[model samples]
Structures are given as C-alpha cells and as structure tokens.
Target: MFHVLGALVFTLVGVRDATWTTDGMAAALLVAGSIGVAGNVAYGFDSVHVALGDTSLVDQAGAAVLIKPLGLFFPLTMLLCAVAVRHVAPRWAAVVIGLSALAFPVANIGNIPALGVAVGVATVVGFGALAMRPVRSPSPATPAASAAG
Candidate 1:
C-alpha cells in the first residue's frame, strides 16, 4: 500500500521534471508493489487452505518467497531517492534518508516488524518530502552595469 502511494507520488513529481532516478524509482515501486499484492494473495490463499483442512498443497515458503524481495526493493527505492535528496534537502533530512536506507533492510530481520512499520512510515514521509521539494533550475546570468570611465 505504501509503495503504491509512493508510485503515485513519484509519478506526479515526475510531471514537474522527469529524471532517470525518479522514473527508475517509480518503476521499481510499480514492480515491487505488484509482487507485494501477489504475496498478499498468497498469504490469504495459504490461510484458506489451512482452514479447508488441506495444508498439504500449501507451501508456507511461498509467501516468504514472494514477499522477501521487498527487503531488497524498499531500501533500493529509498537510497535512490536519497541520492537525489542529498543535495536538495536539509542536512537532517539527508541524514535521516541515509540512515533509513541502511536500516530498512534489517528492520524486520530480528522479528522487529514494529520497527519495520515505523521505518515504513518514515519512508513514506521521506518520499513525500522528496516529491514536494521545489525543483532546482539554473539561475539566469545577469550582466552587471558597466561603470562609466
């Protein structure tokens, strides 16, 4: 769900000025979001199979297989945008983005999904900031008036 929202935000931001970094992030989110949706379906399917007294056909690993790639894509998404934000955003934002990028992959590693969720919220906020940031354009050169001799 978060990634889906992110994709929309990035797409809207892209309308202002498209960049390879932003466009690539949006594409990654789209792909990862699709995988997430399918993983969710697999999760539900596993549950249904268990409820129907037919656990033999369900591979518990299937859900993990589909969902675990998010551990890769989420951070990739964050870091990619982080590179763009590193210069434009405030120092604190840059620090947060960097730490978020490094920490996200491990947030859920130790059964700390609460931490993962918190990081996820931060990711959303970080992305929102990126999307809302005003674009930077080169300033036009103005010739100084020549002093009379």
Candidate 2:
C-alpha cells in the first residue's frame, strides 16, 4: 500500500522536475493509483477471513469472487508504477524498488527474518528517497521577455 503511494510520489516528482506541473506521467500515475487503491479497499474487507482460512465469511452470492484478483492488482500496479518511473527517478530509488519487489516473497510469504529486514530497508529507503526529493520549480521568465511583451 505504501509502495503504491511511493510510486505516485515518484511520478509526481519526476513530472514536477520537468515543468513543476501535471503532465502525462501524472495522469498515468493517477489512473494506476486509483485502480490499486480500489482493489486494496475491496480486498481489505475479506483479508481477515482469507488470512484465517475461513471461507464461511464469503456470502453465497459470490460476493467475494473479486477479492483475490482485486487484491493482486495492488502489487501489480505498484510494479507498473515502478517500471514507469524508473527512467525518470533516481537510480538509487529505482534500485530500492527492485530490491523491495524481490524481497516481498521472502518477507511476507516465506516469513524469512533476513529477507524481511531487506524488504523493510528497501521500503523505508525507497519511500523516504521519493518523499525527500526537492521539487524544483520552473524559473521565472527573464526581464527582457517581460519588457518585450
């Protein structure tokens, strides 16, 4: 979830660096973030039951049919955002994202302590790096241009 937010920030920063305004990259990030957020929210409703291996929580009308697939969209969009911003983001940020993606399985699925630490570091550094980047505003027009106008 935080990873998805970090990706959004990275894209916004990249777009800002160019002109300090929204652009195509910003639009794409918004769309991706929307899909991811929606999926995550829907999945949250069934997460506890799913984690507990209790299928009874699901109603007979197949209300939970979209749970798994939607939940998967969160990570998929995060990855998509990472890839989309890689060329524009700092190299270190990109590297951190890559490490986090790789360590996700060991950290969350396998419950490996060592890999968990790696995932933690990658997440903290990646989000921190993106968050800490300074947004450079476009320079004001020169006096000559104003005078000419």
Candidate 3:
C-alpha cells in the first residue's frame, strides 16, 4: 500500500513536470502518501490486537467503538489516493485506482487477502507506467528544413 502511494507521488510529479506548474497536485500526493503510511501502520496494530483476542476495546453492543476511528482513516487514505491518481493520470489510471477503490469492499466482502495484494501490485505497475518518458524522434527533414530547399 505504501508502495502504491509512493508511485502516486511519482506520477503527480511526472505529470506536473510535463503539463502544469501547480504545486497543489504535488502536495496532494505527498499528503496522501503520508496518510496511507500512517493508516497502514495503525491497521497493523489493529490486526495484532485482533490476533491477541483482545476485544476489550469493544462493548457488549458488538461494536468496536474505540478502534473504529483508526480503521476509518485507512479507507479514507485510500480514497485520497484514488482521487489524486484519477485527476493526474486519467489514462490507464483505472487499472490501478479502480482496483484500489475495490480493495476495502473486497477485503470485507469476500475476506480475500489476495484482493489487497492485487490492488497494491496494480497501483505500482500503473503509476510506474505513468512515470515513463514519452518516445520522441527527430523530424524526417533534411539539414535546414531539408536545407530550406
């Protein structure tokens, strides 16, 4: 996930260097990366808590009233990544951003660990493509616009 966020930052920087001069998009990328890193760390802690079978955080209502806030940030961070990527690289962006968007639902719905892995992989590859330099070649004219013949 962090790798995905990092790729997003690279994409934003690449697009800005090529198209516009706005720092807002670049800043957004950094912010999203920071948030994603933090959220994933928190999620790791939460998973540990669950593994330990420590349900003390939740009440009899079967609600994790305490950990809910921390968990919420993870999805929100992912959403930020999606929005930023979509705005910067709309082309081929869906391959990554779409998978990321489905990560949360897929994780919770089917409880499939592979879904999250796939999303991360897609993000890295998609954004990596965005960072590639455009292919260019000199005009097929002679020396001097064909030597101004």
Cα lDDT, all candidates = 0.51, 0.53, 0.49
For candidate 2, the per-residue lDDT at 38 reads 59
**Cα lDDT over the full model 2:** 0.53
* Candidate 1 Cα misplacement greater than 4 A, ranges: 1-66, 131-149
Q: Write the per-residue lDDT of candidate 1 for residues 32-148, one digit (tens) a residue.
A: 544444443444454566678876223445545554553355455556556544545554665676677678768844647888787767766665665566644322321111211
Look at candidate 1 and give me any clashing residue pairs.
none
The candidate that wins on TM-score is 2
Q: What's model 1's TM-score?
A: 0.49
Q: Please say which candidate is ahead in lDDT: 2 or 3.
A: 2
lDDT of 2 by residue, 41-106 (tens): 654444555568765323434656664455455454445555544544576776777667566645
Question: Which residue pairs overlap in candidate 3's backbone?
Answer: 143-147, 144-147
The residue ranges of model 2 lying beyond 4 angstroms of the native Cα positions read 1-28, 48-61, 102-120, 135-149
Query: lDDT by residue for model 3 over 20-130, one digit each (tens)?
Result: 212554455455545544544545554566679864343324444434454444444445555444433544663465566557656644668887677667755664555
TM-scores for all candidates: the values are: 0.49, 0.52, 0.47
**Residue 11 in model 3: shift from native, Å?**
15
Residue pairs in collision within model 2: none
Candidate 3 residue runs with Cα over 4 Å from true position:
1-38, 49-64, 108-110, 130-149
Weakest ten-residue segment in model 1 by summed lDDT: 140-149
